[model samples]
Target chain A: NAGVTQTPKFRILKIGQSMTLQCTQDMNHNYMYWYRQDPGMGLKLIYYSVGAGITDKGEVPNGYNVSRSTTEDFPLRLELAAPSQTSVYFCASSYGHGELFFGEGSRLTVL
Target chain B: AQKVTQAQTEISVVEKEDVTLDCVYETRDTTYYLFWYKQPPSGELVFLIRRNSFDEQNEISGRYSWNFQKSTSSFNFTITASQVVDSAVYFCAPLTGNQFYFGTGTSLTVIP
Candidate 1:
């Protein structure tokens, strides 16, 4: 059973390029999140969605955008990729605020 | 503001030895949750344990144990007879309301 799946496991983009990190969960969870982890760092929340059509910004939501059109998908978009945005992106989903099921991360490198 | 602190940035211990990873948190909310997660070299997060504010009882499962002290605002994790497979980066997150605060993480290396 694939709990949470993230697309583009690894990607490299030039500065000012744009890309979307796709995330989908099969667990029918209502809460979804996008977090970025820099090298040797902890996870920093970029955005989170409680349910379909409901989204909120977290600690670091500077250059990223997110849309939750359905319960199973929450995609994060980088409008203008920057060198500072080079990090590992993780998508997670949870039933409540308890244990979070995380995807196998997407590593992105911006030149 | 919510904050989780893992004082030890990195620790190296010989296999079969016990290791204790410290986690301290700060929050104004009286009711919150503390958790420990393990991220292996594969870069996937593995849930280790979760403790709420109401439960102060220390828990032990197999070789893993947790010490939760509310007065000190600490929830520490201990691994007895650490194995090579237990080598990973551990994170402590204190979640309050709808947000979570994660520490910088402590990298643990078990040497054979």
Candidate 2:
């Protein structure tokens, strides 16, 4: 089973562009999260969902949006990309809030 | 508000040597959880260990050990007889409820 899979391993977007980062997990976990990692910085939570149809803002949710429509998918949307939005995005799933399993990560570059 | 801190930004140790990574956290809440995660160049995060506020049990796993001191609000990890594969960025995170706060991370390089 593919534990967690993310789409578009790499992407480049111009300022004002919009895109979606797709995340899917086969574990049927109740919790899913979106995080971004900057250079020399640890992962910062962008958004999280406890279950399908439920989502909540996280520490660094200014430039992003998320939706959890099904148990297997939680997608993060960028409304207007900025240079600061260039970072590696990771999707994680867990049985609880503590221990998490992360994806390979989606590298995004905004120019 | 909760914050996690890793004082050492970078650490280097020769293979077969021992090294320790320090982590300190702050939060007003009476109960919380602390965690350590390892991320290599491959980009996936691997969870190393987790400790709650109440439990101060010092644990040893294989060649790795952790010391959790609630009084100092510190959770330290030590690697004994390090190997080249241990080179990675280690992150310390503290969690309150559903939110997790991560530190800047400590980059550990085990050189041959």
Candidate 3:
């Protein structure tokens, strides 16, 4: 079964380019989060949504935007790509603040 | 600030050897959830265990075991008779209130 699915497993973008990383969960979880992991580092929260139409910022949310239009979708947007933004992005969802199931991760590189 | 600390950046062990990954955390909330995830070369984060704050009991499943000691603010994971397949990155996370904190993850390599 597909738990949390992320699109474009790999992507390369130039500085100032823009793109959106897609995330969808079939478990119907209410809490969805966006996290980025740099080389040899742990995951850092970028944005999160408790449910549709509700979003909140996390520790590092400077260059990222997220929208939760539906229960299954929580997409993260990078309006202006930068070299510092190159990292592996992960989409995760949980039920009732429980264990989280993460996507396979989207590896993005900014030149 | 609530933070999860994994002091070990990397560890290498031969096959059939036992290994333990350390995780320390700080949280002000009365209730929280601690978890361990295994990320293999496939780059997928696989959930290994989840322990509640009130439950300080240790849990074991097959070759994996978790030690949750709330008194010490530590939730460590141990692997018995590790195999080559166990080589990967291990992450410890603690969820307090609306935020979940992750450590710098320990990379374990099992050489066969």
TM-scores of the candidates in the order shown? 0.98, 0.96, 0.97
Model 3 chain A is weakest, by summed lDDT over 10 consecutive residues, at A95-104
> What proportion of true contacts does candidate 1 retain?
0.57
**Which parts of model 3 have CA positions greater than 4 angstroms off?**
none
Stronger candidate by lDDT (2 vs 3):
3
Per-residue lDDT of model 1, residues A1-111, tens digit only? 799999999999999999999999999999999999999999999999999999999999999999999999999999899999999999999888688899999999999
Stretches of model 1 off by over 4 angstroms after superposition? none
CA lDDT of each candidate?
0.94, 0.91, 0.93
* Among all candidates shown, the one with the greatest lDDT: 1
Q: Is candidate 1 or candidate 3 better by TM-score?
A: 1
Most accurate candidate by TM-score: 1
Native-structure RMSD, model 1: 0.8
- Model 3 whole-model lDDT (C-alpha atoms): 0.93
Work out how many backbone clashes candidate 3 has: 0
lDDT of 1: 0.94
Model 2 agreement with the true structure over B25-55: per-residue lDDT tens digits: 9988889888899998777899999888998
Question: Where is model 2 more than 4 Å wrong at Cα?
Answer: none
| Per-residue lDDT of model 3, residues A26-93, tens digit only | 99899999999998899999999999999999999999999999999999999899999999999999
Between candidates 2 and 3, name the one with more favorable DockQ: 3
